[model samples]
Target: MAAILAAGAGLHPARNAAAAPMPRVAAAGWAGAQTLLALGVVPLALPEIARYRALVAEPPLPESVQELGLRSEPNLELLTALAPHLIVADAGSVTSPLARIAPVATFAPLRPGRRPAEAAREATLALAARLGRDAEAQSLIAAHEARLAGAAERLSGDRGGPLCLVSDAFGNRALVFGGNSLYQDVLDRVGLRNAFTGATSAWGHATVGLDQLAALDPTTRLVLLTSRVPDARTFLALRPLWRTLPFLREERVTVLADILFYGGLPSADRFARLLAERLAPGNAARG
Candidate 1:
C-alpha cells in the first residue's frame, strides 16, 4: 500500500501537569524526559543538559536541573545523591541499576502495528497514570493534537513532493528513518509522504549509502536531523560524489534543526511546526 494511503494518526494517560519541585523526579533519556516535561514536571536531574539544549531543543530544560554526566552512563553516584522520589527513563531497561535508588518508570519506543504517535500517546498516558497525573496528561495530549491539526491544515496543500528524513552523510552512507519512525508519523500527520521506502530495523531506521539516496525521485527533499552526526553539508560540499545527488543540484534539500530522533511527542511537535513553516507555499528559504 502507498504510505499516504496508510496514513492516520492515539492513549489513557496523568498528573496535574506542574513544574513543582516536590516529588523530585529525575530524567534519564530523551523520550521519557520529554514526556515528563510535557506533563509540566521538570526533572531535578538530567544528563547532558548542554547537549539536550542543542538536540531536543524544545520544552527547554531549566537551569535548576543538575547535570547527570554522560547520557549512556549517567553518574550513578550523583543521581543517587539527588535522592529523587521517581526516576523516569526512556524505553531502556526499567530494572536498571537506578531501580535500587527509587521507583523507576519508562515509556516504550515502539508497539507492534501501532502508529508511532499512538504509541507515544499510550506511553505518555501510562507513565502519567503511574505519577497520578492522568488529567494533566490528557490536557497535554489534547494540546499536542491541536498543534498537529493546525500544522496539517497549514500543509494541506501540496508540499511540491515527498520528503526524506535523514541524519548526517559520511563515506557515501547516511542514516535514513523509515515508515515506522516518529518522524514518519509526524510527516504523515502533516499530510507529507516519506520518500525512503526501504527496509528498516526494529528502531525504524537504516544506514544506507549515498548511492541509494541518489536514486530517489528528484522531487524528494532532505530533512537532516544531525544529532550526533557532524557537519554533513560542509563534508558533502568537499566530496565530489555529493554533487551527483539531483536533490542537491535542484536545491530541494531542507536541513532542519537538531532533534532527538527517538524523542516523544514534543519532538514530533517541533518537527511538525518546522516542516509547516519550511514547506508551506511561499516559504522556500532555508535555515
Candidate 2:
C-alpha cells in the first residue's frame, strides 16, 4: 500500500493493499489522454472528448471517461470530483487551476525545434514511469515505431515527391505546416519531402493565402488536414486560387482527416498510416 503524503497540492491518493498501479487518472489535455490511452489506461476523465474525437479519431476514448470541460478553462469542480491520482495537463494557464484539484504534471505543447514525434515518445515514457506503466509504454512505443517503419518502407520511393501540408483555416487562406512539427516528422519517417521549407511559427505553421501554395513546384502533391471549421469544401470552392492550382487540376491532392499534430506516438502513427495509404504507389492512382 502506498503511504499517504501531502505532496504539494493536497492529498495524494493513497493506494490500497491490492490497488491497481494507477487506479484512476484524469488527463486535462488531449495529448495526455492520448498517452494514457496508449498505455492501455482509460482515463477517469478527459478534456473535451467530443472535440478531441472530431480532431483525433484514432485510439478512441472509451465511453467511461467523464468529460472535464474546455481544454483552456477546465471545470475545477468536475476535476475535483474525479479524484485523479495525477492530472496530466498542458503547461499553461490551465495548470495552475488544475493543480488546486490534484497533483499536476505538465507536458509542453509545440516546443520550438523539438520534433513532435520524438517529444511524444519521451512524454509517453515519462508518463509511464510516473504511473508505473513502463512495460506498457515500451510496447506502445514499439508498436508505434513498427507502424511508422512499415509506412516508410511502403512509401520509400515517394521521397522525392514535393509535398505541402495545409490546414484550411479560412476561405482564402491556409496554415502551412512544416518545420519541427509531428506531421513533418511523420512525413520524414514516411519518406515524403515537405515543400514548405521556409520559416514557421513555433507551432510550425505559416498562414498564407491559397496563391502562396502555388510557389512550390507544380508537381507537388498537396495534402489538406481538414476540420469542421472553415469547411474545406466551402473554402476550396470559394478560393479561386484553389481551382487554378496544378495539383488540384491534375488530381494529385489528398485530404486527410484533422489529427492532433502535437499528440503522442499513437497520433504520429495514425498520421503516417493515413499518408501511406493515400500517397503510396499503387495505393492510389496518381497523375
Candidate 3:
C-alpha cells in the first residue's frame, strides 16, 4: 500500500458491429500489440513474443498469436503467410519490406510535448476506429482514466520523497528517466515528482555517470527498475560510490518490476498502479 489502503486497479468487451468480420491484425512492437488487445482485438502475429513477455509482461498476448522473430527484422516470409488484414508497427521500427507484405499503419506511443498516457488514449481511439472496435475502446479508455485517477488519490499522503526512476547501464553509469519521459508523466499523475529535471532524449532518458546520481538531493528516493537487472542491488553495491548515495544509506531505495518505459497507455497504467502499490511509507519496498 502507498498508504493504509489498496491502490486502485484492461482491455476488451466493447465490440464492433456484428456484421463486420473481426480484423486479423499483426502488431510489430509491444505498444501496438498492447493497443490492439486493449481495443479487444488480438494480433494474429507479433515479433519478439518472448522478449515482450519478459520485458512487458502485461495485457498478455494471447497464445494464438504467432511469434514473428526479431522485432527489428521480423521473418517476412512467415508474416506473409499469416496474411493479416492489417499490420500495425511502431513508426520506423522495421524496414520497408514490412509494408510490402501488408497494409502498414505506424504508431508513435511517445510524442514530444504530449503526455504518453494522453497520447495513448488518442492512439487507442484511433486504433479502435481502424479495427472496428470503437465501443470497446471507449470502455477501455474510461477505465484506464479512472484507474490512474484513483491511484493518484491513494498516494495523496506524500508517503515518501520524490523518486529517481533509473536502471543500471554498466559501470557506475545509469539510464535515468526524467524530464519529459513517460515515467515522468506517470509520476506526476501519481503525485510523485521525478528527481532529475534536466533535458533528456525524445525517448525520455539519459545515460549519466555516478557523478550525476551523486548530485541529486539527499532526500530524493530511488526507484530502481530491476526486472532488467535481477542483480541490480548487488551490482549497485559493487559501485565505488554506491555506499555514498544518501537514499541507499537511509533505506529509501525501492525496486520496481518490468515496465515498457517507452510504451503507451498500457505501460502508463502499469507504472501508475505499480508505483502506488509498491511505494509505501518507510523504505526499500519492491513493486
Candidate 4:
C-alpha cells in the first residue's frame, strides 16, 4: 500500500487503511524506523530521523518519507495533530512520554546470546503482523536471506583473519563487542571470527583500556571500528600510538559504516556486501 502524505505534508498516512488500519507510527530511534520501513510502513513522525542522514548515503532511503521532531522530545502536540493510531518506540528512555502521546509499542535491541538474524527476523514478522502485512514481512525476510546467501557465495574462501570490532576511540578507551552482539551476528554470517572471544554480557558493550588491546594476540588480522564520530581519518590520526599495535603494523584496520554497525536491523547486510568487495580474493592485500 502506498503511504498517504497528509495535507500538511508532514504526516504520511497508510493508503491501505481500509485493508489494514491506518495507524500513525512514531519511531523513537533509527532502528525502529528502519524496521517499520522494511515492513512497508512509514511513520507519521520521527524525532531522531534526521540523525541518520549520513546512513542513507550508502543504502539510501525512499523519497516518500518525511520526518517531524519537536526538539528532543517528539512533539506530542504535533503527534496529536497528526492523529495517529499507533506509535512504535524503543524500550529505552523515551517510552513513557511516547506512550502518553498514544498507544505505544516498544521493542528492545537483540539480547546477547540470541542470534542477531533470528531476532531481527522475528521482530520484522511481529511488526508485519501488527501492521496487517504478514505476507510482506515473509517476503522481506526471504529477500534478506537471498542477499546474504549471494554475498556469502561471492566471498567464499576469502575469509580474512580473526577481526576485532571496536567502537569509540582514543585507543586509551574503547567499546568492543566480544561474542554476543549484533555486530558479531554480521561477522558470523560473513564467515569472520571475532578475536576477543571471552564471555560477553547480556547486552554486550565491554569497555576496556588500550593496554588490554595491546596485549591481544599479535596475529589479529583486522580491526573494524564503529563510532558516532565523523572524520575517520582524523580519529585515526589522533591515535598515533595505535599504529604500534600488531594489527595496525600489518595494515589491517578497517573503519566500518557507523549506521550499519551500531543501528539495529539487518541493515548490516549493506556492510557485509561492502566487506565482501574489499576482502574477496584478488582484492588488494593489506600493506
Candidate 5:
C-alpha cells in the first residue's frame, strides 16, 4: 500500500532529481520543518524556531538550520537574504511575495475534513520526493505503521474511557477538538472515547464555555493542550479550579504535547504510542 502510494505520489523520481545536488530550502511552518527533518534534509531558514523548543527538547538545532522568525509572519528580508532554492510554506502563506522570493511549495498539515495522520504521511512523502529522499520517506512510513500497529495492539483491550480533548489556553473559553481533527484521530487510535463527537468546525476548534465542560462531569477525563503558553507556575496559579475539578481529583487530567497534536508530521504515530503507554490500563501502574 505504501509502495503504491509512494509511486503514485511520484516520490522516487522527485527525490532522485533533488539529490543531484543539495538545494537550499526554507521552511515557513513547524510541520514543514518536521517533514524536512524526517527526510534528513535541514532547512536553511525556519520561521518558527522557538515553538520547537519543547519538540526538540535536549537536542540542539543543527547548524544548517537557521531561525528566520515566527511562523505566523516571517521576515521577508531575512528570507530573501538566505537565497533559498525552495520555499516551503503552508496553504495560508503561499502568497505572491513568497513565490517571488523563491519557488514556493505549499503543504497543509491539517486540512479541513482530512485525517491528521494521513495528512502527515502525505506531507512527508511529498516533501521527501521533492527533496530527493524517497527511500528515507518510505522507511519513515514503515516505521510509523509499525508504531501505530503496536499502539493499537497495546490499546486493543481498552473498553473506551470517556475523554475530552481540550485546547485550554484562556481561563474561561476553551476549544474542543472533535470530528475530523487530529485529537480525534489520536483518541481513536488509543481506544479512548471522545465525549463530544458531534458537529465540529473544519479548523478543529470548537469554543465551549465552562458550563458545558462542567456538565460533561466527573467521569470524563480531560486532556489539556497548550503550546508553551504561560509558565507552568503561572498557569497553575491561574487555574486552581482545574486541579480541583473532579476529573483532576480522580487523576484523570492528562497534559499532552500540543505540538504533536497540532503541528505533527508523519510522527503522529509516536504520539499514539505515547498515549497508549500512558493511558493503557495497568501500564501506568506498572510504570
Candidate 6:
C-alpha cells in the first residue's frame, strides 16, 4: 500500500541530485527497464535481460547490460557490484534492499484505483524527466497515440467491433483480462470492446474455469495472449465446453505471442500493433 502511494506521486525522488545524468543505472523490474529503454536510456543492468530479449523481441537491450536475475528477487551481490548511481523498480516490488546500494525510484503501471493505461503514460513521462529526456518522451507518446488512432481508423468498419475478449490460459484455469486491465484501455482506444463483464482483482484479472467462455456472447471473439509451454489449445482440447464455445468452433480465436501485460508505454504500443494486425472483426465473423 505504501508503495502504491509512492507511485501515485509520479517517480519517487532520487536521493542524490548531485548524481545528475545517473552515470550508471539499473532496473530491478521489467517495466522499469522498458521505460528506461523507451526514453533511450540504456540501463547498465536489468532483471532477466536474456529472458526479456526472448519474450519481447523488438527494441533490444544492449549486450553490455548485466542480468540482475529475477525481477522479484534481484541478485543483491551482482547489483551492488554494478555500483549504479540509480536503480529503478516497480511500485509493487520490494526495493528496500536496493536503497542501501543506490538511489531507488519506483514506477507503477497499475497504481491503485487509477487506470493502468493512464498510469503507464504517467510513468513514462516521469521516467523521461528523471533522465532529462522529456522531449524524447513526448515524441514517443505522440507516436503511440498516432498508432492507436491509426488502428482505430483501420478497424472502423469492423462489424463486431466491441465484442472481443482477451485472455491468457494455464492448465485448467483462464486468466480473463477486462474492466481495469490495460488491455481494456487499448481495446477502447482501438474502437474494440472487451466482452468480459466479470469482477476483476485490483491488478485487473479474474481466474475462472474454461466453462466461463461458454457464458460469453455467441458472437464474442477470443484473442489469446499465448505462452510457449502448456499451449492453450492442448489443454482446452481436454474440455468439452472448450469445444462447444462458438469462438473456438468457428475458428474465431486469434493467438498472439505473450507481451508484457503490465509494462509501460512501449508495451502498450506493442499491444496496439499486435491487436490491430491480428484483429479482423469482419473477416473472423464472416468465417
Best model per TM-score: 3
Question: RMSD to the native, candidate 2?
Answer: 4.4
lDDT at residue 210 of model 4 (Cα atoms): 73
lDDT winner: 1
Q: Show model 4 residue runs off by greater than 4 Å.
A: 1-18, 55-59, 62-66, 70-72, 227-234, 260-264, 284-287
TM-score of each: 0.87, 0.87, 0.88, 0.82, 0.81, 0.86
**Candidate 3 residue 64 C-alpha distance from true site, Å:** 1.2
- Model 3 stretches astray by more than 4 angstroms: 1-18, 229-232, 238-240, 281-287
By summed lDDT, the worst window of 10 consecutive residues in model 5 runs over 3-12
Q: Distance (Å) between predicted and true CA of 267, model 1?
A: 0.9
Question: lDDT of all predictions, in order shown?
Answer: 0.74, 0.73, 0.74, 0.62, 0.65, 0.73
Better of 1 and 2 by lDDT: 1
Superposition error at 12 for model 6 (Å): 13
Residue 67 CA displacement from its true place in model 5, Å: 1.4
Q: After superposition, how far is residue 284 of candidate 1 from its true place, in Å?
A: 2.5
The order of the candidates by lDDT, greatest first, is: 1, 3, 6, 2, 5, 4
lDDT of 3 by residue, 81-181 (tens): 98876788874585468777766666676777776667666767667766667788889878877988988777777656678888655777788988778
Going through the candidates in order, what is the number of backbone clashes in each? Answer: 5, 0, 0, 1, 2, 1
CA error at residue 183 for candidate 1, angstroms: 1.1
What local lDDT score does residue 203 receive in model 4, on the 0 to 100 scale? Answer: 57
lDDT by residue for model 6 over 109-225, one digit each (tens)?
Answer: 787688887888887777666656778889988988998898887777777624544455565567888789888888888878788889988877899876776778888877777
lDDT of 5 at 75: 87
Model 4 agreement with the true structure over 145-233: per-residue lDDT tens digits: 77777767767886466777776665477777777777677777867777877666665558777777777777676545454444334
How far off is residue 67 in model 6, in Å? 1.0
